[model samples]
Target: MKNALLIIDMQQGLFHGPHIPYAASSVLSNIRLLIKKARSSGTPLFFARHTGPDGSPFSEQSPLTQLIPELDVNVEQDSIFIKKYPNCFRDTVLLQQLKLRNIDQLVIAGMKTEICVDTTCRAAFDAGFKVVLVSDAHTTIDNPALTADNIVRHHNQTLAGPFVSLVSTEEWVA
Candidate 1:
């Protein structure tokens, strides 16, 4: 199975503000590790950036839509797909790009586990790609309905069997 790494919405806007994702530091670190591993293993990396309406953090004119500075994104080497919805495939060329490269397995990680991360994971599965979700490399902010920790846990459990194979950053990297 050919492998590719799909990083969803690890944008500056999502990391800042009052509602920082749970375990932001560790999640970022894990994602960095994944990136390193993918580079070393010759796995292609695809980054998804979410766009929002004007006045929102992810607006086209907002710097928040930019990828986090901590991530070493090479415009020349990495593939970036701009998305306007929670499901990265909704209006993006991500699937086409992956197909062009003959990628059949996707290792997905990034921000907002309950939203973009979750939606993209399922979409990738429905699109017939074998998906591996980096369990510790994705996160979300706490909501009134559930703590961020619980949200991550819930999505991981729910999506594992049906939508993805669950792996850790260490496992994937090693």
Candidate 2:
């Protein structure tokens, strides 16, 4: 049951937009706590940053491509995988890297719950890695049809099952 913590797209660019994701502050705090625990527990930590072609918010050179300042991502220790599409695994060495580290179970958390978070969770499960979705550690902005709160709630329920295990930061850290 070797495990690794996977953080996706908690980039500075995500905060620049007008609509902050639901519970953004709480999510950040929880993720920071998770990072702290991982560091002390000797758990491996990995980050996936989104980088899109020119004109996208995640441009190659954009400062937003970097993780938020508050996150304690040590380049020498934690590995970072960059993705251009929704699925973080595609065109990325994430799977291979995880395999190299002998990681079979992944504890995943990060921003935009409906997009990268959801996509990566499904993909990781399909790829045969057991996944834990840190329930309150991910978030998204409200859409026209649903509030961000509802979106997070919907995904938390819908994504739980054979594909993913939904748990809070407390449960995950323990």
List of clashing residue pairs for candidate 2: none
lDDT of 1 at 92: 90
User: Stretches of candidate 2 above 4 Å error?
Assistant: 54-57
| True lDDT of residue 102, candidate 2 | 94
lDDT by residue (tens digit), candidate 1, 1-174: 999999999988887756778999999999999999999998999999899888986687688888987889989999998899999889799989999999999999998999999999989999999999999999999999899999999999999999999999989998
Error of 1 at 74 (Å): 0.8
lDDT of 2 by residue, 29-87 (tens): 99999999989988899998899888876787788888887897899999988899889
Query: Model 2 lDDT vs. the true structure?
Result: 0.90
Candidate 2 at 85: error in angstroms? 0.9
Best by TM-score: 1
- Pairs in clash, predicted candidate 1: none
Error of 1 at 142 (Å): 0.3
